[model samples]
Target chain A: MQKVMMGNHALSWGAKLSRAEVIAAYPITPQTEVVELLSNMCADGSLKAEFIKVESEHSAMAASMGAAAAGARTFTATSSQGLALMHEVLHWATGARLPIVMGNINRAMAPPWTIWTEQTDSIAQRDTGWIQIYTSSIQEIMDSVIQAYKVAEQVYLPVMVVLDSFVLSHTNENCDIPDQDKVDAYLPRFENAYRLNTDKPAAFGGLTGPDWYYELRYKIEKDTERSLDLFEETGKEFGEMFGREYGLVETYKLDDADTVLVASASIASTARPAIDQLREEGHKVGLVRIRVFRPFPSELLRKLLAGRKKVLVIDRNISFGMSGAFYAETKAALYNEKKAPPMWGYIAGLGGRDVPLNVIRDMIEQTIAEEHPEGDIVWIGVKR
Target chain B: MLEIRFHGRGGQGTVVASKVLAFAVAREGRFVQTFPEYGVERRGAPVVAFTRIDDQKIYIRSKIYEPDHLLVLDPTLIGAIDVTEGLKPGGWIIINSDKPAKDFPQFAGFKVATVDATSIAVKHRLGSAAAPIVNSAIMGAFAKITGFVGIEAVREAVHELSPVKKDENVEAAQEAYDTAEVPKEQS
Candidate 1:
């Protein structure tokens, strides 16, 4: 049925439809509602799941690890400081090869105490070995959560379905909640050979010496590489079922375009209008929204971005002294290509600051006007 | 697309009002998006929420700068904050106030309508006078004056969304719908 629902509720519906058997979460701002509704669903017997109101984010992920180890489909949701708190367990889940699905509402890390949208929280966890997918709308948030389970279980890697805090979390949008039977057919129960079973007891996450540790790390890398293909296949299956197709990267008005702007999450959604406005004014501008961040989709990006005259990346995050994390990755992805666009990076919309239509237009115009960009990263809309 | 901006203090159901309207419109087969703009969120602090309704899907996710309509849930918010800062000329402003529409400050040449939502809330005892839950009442005036959404749509929304005060909310909305008045000059 179609309903105008909050983005946080969308995550709850996704977890319900996916038939997650165990939901362990600690409430945090912007992320609190996602699990609050889940707890209600659990209490009402609508979801038929165990809702664990853990004391901390670490306990939430740790409980999910235990549940997934015990052969249950597990899930959790958190943001910002909560995600930071779960960092240690995040690595544990990945290293244990637990196919846990988590919803990370991307919020700014606080010294000033903000509960607003920012990508730094999730971007900082890029090396944690979880497959991360950022969504731009409520429907994508729901669909990605379902697809995330399929991809994670396929390759035995945890998946983080990430979206901006309020940009999507607090926004209400029309979304089609797929029929339960259709979702059941799309994502079957999690049945894996590695799950903890009383019938076949095995040691999990035990310490490994230097001889075996390196090979286990290498295997994780190899499986992560395999996830890219699995993600495409899963996306195709989802498209056939729901009629909304998704990919690691989605392009808009790219045909016969010389300039392309790249972004992720809700900012990417905001870019469509700027691209359309520019196109109407007869500027050959396009947009490439990066949906999946982990397993980076480097090959597809290199192929799509190689021939453009200019590429502008808008990152809602920074990697401190270097550049936008996405900017550095995109550049590194195309470094060896014969024909690569001169990519410029701009950091915008941190801590839930609005990214207006004019700011987007200005970024595009600046990218077009500059012959050689002055810096590796430019701060857009900073008062200075 | 019809873009709307809502003005209310924190804890006054500003976001809830936007979502209720969005869902009502979506239930009628139109695409709708609703969200709020706030910081830190202390009660009585001014806050704004936005809603967009269209026959087609919306792509823009930024805050509405130029709203086609404004729903002001607090009378005192006028002048304190620029409630009509970006309201389009000739747009509608459905405000929650007991004063006559003409007595309210002229809002940049926009059409004005007034509803005594606080009065209706007090009559129904939905919430305390200090913090009257006026979103449902304001939404009712919005539906009746604008006619974009049917009054029954608001009733259904309140019935579904309100947990304990469903009946009272529905009555509050219905009373406001019947009692709201548009200024003669604007009408």
Candidate 2:
């Protein structure tokens, strides 16, 4: 059954197929359609789930944390200011290791009331412990949602599946949605090593002494490191059952390429074709689409970019006065590697202005042409 | 290849028109892609939804900045956004308007087709003229204009999206199809 569905529809269907036990969302922009579909599914008895009408994004996260704490799979969604409103709770959800899944439809912040797509929303909240996965297509949106539940439950880390605001969130694609029974076989049940119940009756988040706190924090980091492999194993097992694979670093035409563009979200679709066009014109260009943004995948990224001549990162969100957000992450990922290519960051599409293929082509060609590639950042496609 | 761009407000079934058209066209064994481009997806924002129908896959992602056929649900968007932005030379435009096609010569390419879809929607008991959701009807017009899709296919697509108001929407679609006039093609 092939049908054109927007990213929002994909997210709803993804959550539905995951057999999400609880869903709480407040209507917002591109995100409204997703919650609408899920609510309709709940109302019509197709999804047999509890669709909570939360008053705000804050309450949405709170409800998800509650459901997750109760040992049931939970899901919620928000965008822009709504996501910002849940900023503090986002940290709490991840810190509590509730394994809640959320969809953040990327949207620009307000000053002049713009609802367009941008990466600022999610990128602003990157420091939180949640495993952030950005989607480039509706298919990925669906696939990632299911995988997100699996990964979050495995690692005890909440996951945020981020997609572009009106662009990817509302754009329709002929995505293949897996059957429910098959999805059930792949993602079975949520059995947490730490849970809330009368029998267990233990404090989930409690005060810690300064003496044991350092080691406990170190253990959390160590557990996160260990979960990286667990996440990969779960994704592979998911692919074996449902026939769609996912990973932290998804390489596209990077083999034997002299230059590669690192990006995420719907921009990957645009970059793929642009890379093909550049390659056809006898340019050695490719793309590295980051599926998993958290845990950074530094080692895998370093291994992949080892042989490439130059790597350019296109960050849709800026770190304000600093360089691009992912720009520093990628630099650190490749640092101390053997003969690594000079990496440059090109920030574009900050406010949902389209990141055109022509600009991608221009950036790659300019990077390839540069003798030194000396600048800290190369701002591509700027009028001024 | 017949590509139609629907121009309307956010809640006017503009995006669904593209989807239904694609679904109907897909039934006719043609490869199709339908999508909408709008900033906010809000209630009253001007939106552009496009459908590409051909024997091949659509690789062009850029806005139908130019369209071979135009379906304008809100005539006011005619002046707001260029209803004829990328309309092919001499392309036909089917608009829901009270005025005759001759009065909007400036907006139409060489050929203009007008239908009182709002009044039709009203007569069919669809809604008030203020928020006349002429999407299904306009999609029906799209079918008749190009004959790329049949009434049965449009009905099936409409059913997939919803079952309520099926009969009225089907009739509205059929009326638009029967009344829509095709203009001469450009070289």
Candidate 3:
């Protein structure tokens, strides 16, 4: 049935539909509603799950890891500071091969203190061995949570379904909530062969010497790589059941375009109209929205952007001294290609500043007008 | 696409008003998006919310700059802020005021509609007499003035969304729909 709900509620509904066995979460702004609804569902007997109320985000992840270790489908959610606090356990969840699905609202990290939308928080965890999937809309948020669990359980690695804070979390949009029976058919119960069983008497997360530690790390890397294909297959199967199908990278009007704008999360959603406007004005512009950030989708990006006339990357998260994280990753992805286009990196909409269609248009127009990018990092709408 | 900007203070259900309207729009099988512009989020602080209704999916995730219409829940916000800052010239401005629509000469260029949402809300006991909740009443006036959403849809949305005073809120909306002073052409 179609319902108008905030993105946070969509996450709650996704967790409920997945029939998560355990929910461990700490409430934070934007993300508070996610846990609030889940708690209500748990209390009202709608979703029969053990809702664990933890002290902090760290404890939330720890409890989630414990539940997943015990062979339960565990779910948790946090934003900015909350996610940052879970950094240590985030690595542990992956290292232990627990398929815990977490919803991370991408809020900007605070020293100046903000609760608004930004990608830096999730981007900082790129090396945590968690599969990161950035979602743009409420429907994607709902669908990706279920898909994340399937892909995570298949590969035995945790998945972080990330979305921008207020842009997607607080916004109410129309979404077709998949029927419970249909969802059950699409994603069967998660059974972990490696789960901790008292009768089995197995040692878990025990200290490993130098001889086995390196191989353990390598196995995780290989499995993380293997999840790319697993994600694709699962997404296709999900599409067959549900109407909307998702991919690692979604392209808009790129078949015959000279200039393409690359972005992730809500920024990508905002760029579609700019691409359409530019196309109408006779500018051969298009958009490539990077849905999956962890597995990187490097091969797909390299293939799509190899021979373009110009490529402009808009990143909402900057890497301090270097460039935008996506900019660096995309450039690295295409470095060896002989026919790679002249790419430009732009940092915009950081700290939740609005990146409207006009700002996106300006970035594209600037990239198109210049022969080559004057600087490594082009900051848009920043006051000097 | 039709865009609407809602103006009200915090604790006045400004954001919920936008969501309720969007819910009504969505019930009619159209696409809709509604979200508030977040600040420090204190009670009585000026709150701004937006709703976009379109035939197709809305991909723009930015704040609405040039809204096609305005919904002003607090009439006192008229002088404090430009309630019609980015409103379209001929678009409707639905205000929750006891006075007639013509009383607001400042909005002469645009179509004006007024409903005593506070009185209606108080009469229905939706909230206290000092600070009555006026969102549903204003939404009723909006449905009456613009015909963007049907009164039935509004009633259904209010019935589903209102937490405590479900029947009272629905009655408030119906009363406002009956007595809202809209332009003759629009009426």
Candidate 4:
């Protein structure tokens, strides 16, 4: 059915459609609505799932891990501070190899206290062994949630399907929700031999001696490395089922372009029109929307970004002391190439700051004008 | 594509009004997007929300800066914020005031319309007179003036969105649809 609803509702619908047996989540701004609706669904018996309204994000994640370890499909949602609170348990979920799916509404970290959108909160969790996928629209949010389960369960890694706080979470759009039976076919019930059973009790999360711990860590690293291909495969299968195609890195008019701008989350959606406008005016500009961040999709990016004369990276979050995190990662991805394009980084639209079309056009025009930019970090829309 | 901005106070259903418009447009098989500007969360604070409707899919996630139409749900919000600031040339502004169109502030380059939505809401008992919920009535006036969306769709949307006072909302919308008046110059 097609309904015009918020991106947060799309997350809840995705969980309910996937028949997630256990949902453990705490309320947080921009993320609270997703959990609240899921709680209502659980209460009304519209969805036959266990909704655990925990006190904090830590308890929420711990509960999800517990349910997943007990052979149940688990889900959760958090943003900003709540996500920071779950940082410790995030590693625990991945180490336990639990296929827990979480919707992380990315928000700027607080010192001045903001509930606005930013990407730092989720990007900061890069080393946690979880596969992260950023979405641009509410439809993509729903679709990605379902696909996350498929990819995560296959590789035994947790999946974080992320969107910008308020930008995507609060925005309402018409989304074509897939039928439950089709979703069931795309993502089957969880079935694995490695689970806790009361009849034949087994030990889990026990202390591992240093001799054995090294190999266990190696296996996790190896599995995470394997997820790059698995993510693409899952996206392909979802495309076949739902008629909406997805990929690790989605490109717009990048086939023969000399300049390409890179962005993720909601900003990528904003970049598309700017690219279109530039194209109409006979500029050889394109946009690359990075959907999959973890396992980085470095090979795919390397392939798409090859032969381009210039690359512009737009990051809504900063790494401080360094340039934008995405720019740093993109530069690293192309480090080994003999003659990589000069990638320029621009930071824009932090903490709910509005990004107009002119700012994006300015970024492209500035990149085209300079052989070497003025600085490593170009702050767009700043007062100076 | 048509861009719209809604100006109202918090707790006045400004956000919900945009959602209903987006939903109605989507139901008509056109693509639509609706969202509000996030700011300090406080009741009675001025709030701004936006909606965009297009025959093609919308890819721009930015706020509507050049709104083709502006709907002011609260007349008092006029001087409080720049309600008409980035309005496109020859755009339309629909105000919910009962005053005559000449009595309202004039925009040299824009068309204007007025609907006594507060009176409509109060007559139908949609909410108290002090805090009249004029979202549906204003939407009704929007539909009547612009003809961008059908009146039936607005009625259906209000019925679906309002948990209580369905009849009052429907009546309020119908009254606004009938009574909405365009500026003398434009007419």
Model 4 agreement with the true structure over A26-95: per-residue lDDT tens digits: 8755456999999999999999999998889999999999999998999999998888999999999999
- Runs with alpha carbons beyond 4 Å of true place in candidate 1: A28-31, B182-187
Best candidate, DockQ: 3
Candidate order by TM-score, decreasing, is: 3, 4, 1, 2
Interface RMSD of 4: 0.9
Task: Estimate the TM-score of every prediction.
Answer: 0.97, 0.89, 0.98, 0.98
Q: Return the clash pairs for model 4, or none.
A: none
Residue A165, model 2, lDDT:
76
Interface RMSD, per-candidate values to 1 decimal: 0.9, 2.7, 0.4, 0.9
Against the true structure, what is model 2's DockQ?
0.32
Second chain alone, TM-score for each candidate:
0.95, 0.86, 0.96, 0.94
Give lDDT tens digits, candidate 2, residues A1-384: 566678888999999999999998886543558899999999999998899987888888988888899988999998888998899999888778788889888988886677777888898898877788888777889988998887788778888999987677876756678988888887897787677889868877788788877886676577667667766887788778767777786777888788888988767767887888888999888888887888788888888887678888888888877777777889888888887888888888877787766777788888888876676887776787
Per lDDT, the best of the predicted structures is 3
* Docking quality (DockQ) for each candidate: 0.83, 0.32, 0.93, 0.84
What ranges in model 3 sit over 4 Å off?
A: A28-31, B185-187
Cα displacement (angstroms), candidate 4, residue A90, comes to 0.7
In model 3, which residue pairs have backbone atoms overlapping below 3 Å?
A: none
Q: Where is the poorest 10-residue window by lDDT in model 1 chain B?
A: B178-187
lDDT at B50, model 4 = 97
User: Which ten-residue region of model 1 chain A has the weakest summed lDDT?
Assistant: A25-34
> How does chain B of model 3 score on TM-score?
0.96
How would you encode candidate 2's per-residue C-alpha lDDT over B7-93 as one tens digit per residue? 898778888888888887776666776777765568889988888787865433445556788888888887787678767887777
